[model samples]
Target: MTNQTSEQFWEERYRNMTGQPSGRPTGKLVEFAEALPPGRALELGCSRGDDAIWLASRGWQVVGVDISATALAVAAERAKAAGVSERVRWEGHDLAQSFPEGMFELVTALYFQSPIAFPRAEVLRRAAEAVAPGGVFLLVEHSTAAPWSFKSRTPFSTVEETLASLQLDESWEPILVGAPKREARGPQGQTAEVLDNVIVLRKRPA
Candidate 1:
């Protein structure tokens, strides 16, 4: 899909959301980042901002980026409710066209997927570049389709493939690389074990 089409699609999706999210950060995000020292963070496809809020609550200044303005608004409100509004900033971007400025000590993109045609690989590469030296870039992606997902038949790239696509040099060190299985709950309360491709890379100090 074109960039305009993708924006409209995400906008409509978030606009129809019935209520706020569960106010829970993705389990993988908390698992990997909970022990890290707080610093600047950038969360791509922040959805309703649970991850960003979690980071901000831990004293990390956060910038949450998403394509849907409605989603950003909802996330901003959520940050306010969590008393971390001052620590979080929200920006709307069609990442195909532009990205948030500056670098981050912790950059995360969890399940950054879309059914529409998007340059996901390119965007992810840019995300890596935005990671400051000695900082971490954590990526988690669906390795298998969820039962309730509209893109059930869509094939996902493996962790190795994704890392290769980034084309990082020796300045990047692989901290974690594997497909991990996690128990997941579907939209209708159905439960299943799902596979996720995870890669955590730390940029070597300059």
Candidate 2:
């Protein structure tokens, strides 16, 4: 599907949903952020802007980009509620088409899923290109197609496979890449174990 179509799909989903889809930063993102230097940050697929708001609250200038305008609105409200509205810039963007310009101190792609019809390689390449020198790129994605309510059937690649497919630049260093089990609330309000593959890469100085 084209980026425009993808954007519309997400917009409709958020518009119809009862409440905010996501409310907090993913665990992996929280850990990654704690280790990075605070500066300009960009969050791709920001959903309702939990991570972006969290980053902004920590004094990092943040730009939260999502395909859904409704989602961005909720994110903006969240920032206001959190008392950091001025620190965040919310924008509607389709990652498949183009990425925001500028070098970022940190870039986060957390649990951003796409249908089988979408092109994953191009998305990953664009994400890699958006990272600035001495910046960090953190990716946290579902590692398995477990029978969860929010699960996607699109076959997920391992961190190793993704990095190998991308042929990352020599200046980019892989800090951590592996599958980790996490506990999350299931559809029925029960606890379930989910596997997530995390990829933390840092760009070397120019």
Candidate 3:
């Protein structure tokens, strides 16, 4: 298991892992954001930068952050390859220690779970605080374990729990907060049904 005290764990994981970028954008992200006008965006734990690239391609100036330098390196390559380098900036940050500076129009933490326990809820609260008025904060988490997945068996926090942790007032409007079902495929080409906890909130314009 990886530990937050050791950035090398993550650095090594990305340095050794072999795979292609999941080029397809998160379905939930596309479904909800496709029509929204582009603006500044921030992605937490942006693994290989696919989501950031997608946002950049859509005209959103993006800052993609992760703790792993190797991962950010690959993400930088992808951004360059996609010709969106000018619009996207890849940043390395141990989010548990600090966050990227600047407010954003759209903030996301898609599948940002870590094997090692970290201050995720607190980080999320900060994420919300960084969202500009009229901006959106999007969170997508796995609701349950998949048969083919290798993730920790830790139970996922519910949308209600997550929302509660933020302690937002009426100034924030909940767009969606519930677990939705979806079909998924395993590495072996096996299929199964899974549920995902999705939360979308927009801050009321001041």
Candidate 4:
């Protein structure tokens, strides 16, 4: 199997994709971020920049990181068309190889899972480290994959399991950790019940 974490693999995948982003931010992001004040935000695996653009529109300066250069280019164009081009920046990196620099007031990894093997825990730990003091780190992962997903039969890690892997210290305050069920819409408009492991943490201010 080709390494799914490689830049080439993701670039190929994005190059074949059709249409633009849905323009709707994930429900979890909107729910949690709406109350917080605007600040620098980092989005890990920002596929088409929908969520990043949404944050930018909300007065937050956003840095969207993706593994696919093609996706970044398309997302940048979409951002420019949205009239929030100055609020968002795009970068391409293979998380297994490199990560973006600087800290952020908000760091998010939503549905950041792959069908193939990868160093996901290590990447997420690095993501946690990028959160500035008193910043929020939100992770939403698939506890139960959607029917159309490539990982449909794969066993998912629970909230406890993921937290154990993260090895967060007392300096991080857990705001929310649970498995929430939601209705997920598939690519062809099919809907199914899916569960997500949601973890929201805040780094203690110095």
TM-score of each: 0.96, 0.90, 0.94, 0.95
Model 2 scores a C-alpha lDDT of 0.80
Per-residue accuracy of model 3 over 93-143 as CA lDDT, tens digit each: 989899999999999999888767778888999899999999999999887
What is each predicted model's overall lDDT from 0 to 1? Answer: 0.91, 0.80, 0.88, 0.90
Clashes of each: 0, 0, 0, 0
Runs in model 1 with CA error above 4 Å?
1-4, 152-154
Best first by TM-score, ranked: 1, 4, 3, 2
The count of residue-pair clashes in candidate 1 stands at: 0
The residue pairs found clashing in candidate 2 are none
Model 3: residue 153 alpha-carbon error in angstroms: 5.5
**Cα error of candidate 3 at position 31, Å:** 1.0
lDDT of 1 by residue, 1-206 (tens): 34548788889989887865988989889988998899999999999998999999999999999999999999999899899999999999989889999999999999998887789999999999999999999999999876877573257998889989999999999989999899888777899888999999899999
CA lDDT, candidate 2, residue 161:
82
RMSD of 3: 1.5
Alpha-carbon RMSD to native, per candidate = 1.7, 2.4, 1.5, 1.5
Q: Write the per-residue lDDT of candidate 4 for residues 95-184, one digit (tens) a residue.
A: 878999999999999988876567899999999999999999999999987778775325899889998899899999999999999999
- Candidate 1 residue 183 Cα shift, in angstroms, is 1.1
Error of 2 at 11 (Å): 1.8
